[model samples]
Target: MNAVKIIAASPQEALEQVQAQVGPDAVILNVRKLPIDGMKKLWAKPQVEVLAAAPEQEPGEQESLRQLAVKVQQLEGELHARGVVPTETVPSPDAKLPPKVMQMIRAAQGDKLEEALLPAVQVLEQIGLLPSHARWLSAQSRNFLGATKPRNLPEEMELLREVLSEYWHQLARRLEKPGNPVRVLVGTPGSGKTTVLAKWATQETFLRQRPSRIWRLDADRPNTAEFLSLHGELLQVPVERVWDPDEQPPEDTLRLVDFPGVPADQP
Candidate 1:
């Protein structure tokens, strides 16, 4: 099978492009960071090169996964050789980071014990997280790691996993309030409102075995994202184009609505 070359800014975008072009059954063959030239290397954000192809004409699921795993090992080896993935021989406290996280290793370790959390806080702030929120998370991590004194980098990383696991385990429970059957997903534009709706739909429809439908309504702008419609078709969930805000939804069946994101600056 002929493979298609895709260059995308992130893995999610690359996956979306592959799904759109080669169908959801498509298998990824290889992935790598694209090269930057000249002075562009100083300021340019990195792009990823993905090699993928349709599977019906090629290998089945098991074969596809094996090929994908081999490709991943090769990619990881290349990164490790280039000093991107740290090995045991490196032996630097600052170079090692949390599993699968490469950028969180930048903060220099200082003499103060609290400075150990500096790297995580900086990473959060870089992604538009508020300083206050970062501090709160850091404090929470400290609480879990309190029994152990003078935590090292590895211990701090383990603390992050523990905190994340605790919070996400709570979030994985049933999604509903006592009196609410209709739930609407709302957020700033590009904040994954539709994606969250799809997840909720999966739980409501497939896992719960409950009757559910999806409503795609405009929030401030037109809800142009095709993801909801595509996902609705896949799950066999009835999808409606729009609904009048003045009308109350039927109480018997669960209704998940997809809303366009409002600007964060707007009221």
Candidate 2:
């Protein structure tokens, strides 16, 4: 309960009016002089403000909190290594940073952290680190190295693996089942394609449980075809200068081709 007493031009008149009205034990919280308003005006007088005291903290409770703070500080020091450890030790300030905070700071700081940590991040992620952990470490490392974190890692390694798996599965599905060898040897001139093919054929025959007969296409000319035939005889494989639809290639045989460049106007 609260009370306010207003002083008038005559204190005795005000006291008499209050005594005749409310009892005298009523506490007075404010006392102010009202400015005179003209008799012609019926407007209210301006009021002065008086505020209450705020609640104070208990001394015992405050002491307990201080003690708790000291204990927490001691525990924190014990849990973490001290003496200005390198930035590398800490979790990524950038990667683990809340996204909204990162965005705001990046807008202010600009490509500041990305330059240093992006390469490391890509390397680590490629080796199968969890996404969040990879990003956090990358971001942190970048900030530690005094650079802005990259916006994205080059994830081509993982993407490439996925694409290769898909491609192999599609190829196998197209074949429908295991069959004889199919080989494509393509390279610039003097790339050792012939030597590589021979080595691979040897591997297939001995290690892969599949013996192969190799064929070299010789559609160029009679002289070239004769030379290839001589070479094929040395390698113990068949050589042909033309296609034969009715003849089956040797079991599990790989056919190799060398193509000449197209003429300017040829379709």
Candidate 3:
């Protein structure tokens, strides 16, 4: 494989350049927004950098590309060590993060965390927590750091995890149980609301031996009623299509209501 980096005014432009140079079969490895420098920061738009690899070539070419990649990595490391490149590329988190989460952060924020809070943020990322959740936990950890004596990275991580787990446990206990007998599933089109309803109905009818019925709201979309009817057959329950608000099922049975999905632009 032959890999090359392309920088352009926008991601779309960069993609065009890659397609033109390496053809459609090229694999995109990474995309990042580059930082602007000096006077260019004032008026020039930030550029997007795309790293792409051509499909497998000859054996000699593959070996050459591998060597080139290693050399490039070494050069980048040297630049970072010499302070020629910005520190944003280097995440100073003491712990390693999961590859998936690391990729997500890199794509979203260029793998950058505030330097002072890198350790805490890294611990959160390692546990596969969302960025918002990590930020909140990081803030609480910072408070603890200030109130107590300094600790090692591992100790700090353990303390923060304990604190966060306690908070979630307390939250789960405080949440009120659902009082309403009727349950409704809602989401955008093809969001798996119907499938979820089917699974729930199956659990009730087969596992718990509780009687359940499905009520689907009629809308512009097609095949919803048919789909629910199929699930109804499997569950040995009746599936009803309701257009009017006043339509009701038997009072004794568990009812699963399926509301039509609305587009974001619709009123």
The order by descending TM-score is 1, 3, 2
Residue pairs that clash (backbone atoms under 3 angstroms), model 2: 92-140, 112-147, 112-148, 113-147, 113-148, 113-149, 114-147, 114-148, 114-149, 114-150
In terms of TM-score, which candidate is stronger, 1 or 2? 1
Give the worst 10-residue stretch by lDDT in candidate 1.
85-94
- Stretches off by above 4 angstroms in model 3 are 1-134, 140-175, 178-180, 187-191, 218-225, 243-252, 260-267
Cα lDDT tens digits for candidate 1, 1-267 = 779998988755775687688766555556676899999989998887777777546588677656755654555455446665221121134433454443332333223233233344334444576655565667677776434643433344445656877877778665535765667777788896776676667556545777778898775588897656755654577788868678665666788888888887998
TM-score of each: 0.43, 0.30, 0.39
Candidate 2 local lDDT, 1-267, one digit each (tens): 434354444433443344344343322223333565677246664442221121233469557656655654454454344442223232255466788886786687664543333443445454576656655555445334323433422232223334446657889889774665446565544464554554455344334645455556532322222333433433345555555668776666665553332333454
- Cα lDDT tens digits, model 3, 141-168, are 6665434533644445455756677778
Least accurate 10 contiguous residues by lDDT in model 2: 48-57
Global lDDT of model 3? 0.64
Candidate 2 runs further than 4 Å off = 1-151, 175-178, 181-192, 205-211, 218-231, 249-267
- Residue pairs in steric clash, candidate 3? none
**Per-candidate local distance difference test:** 0.64, 0.45, 0.64
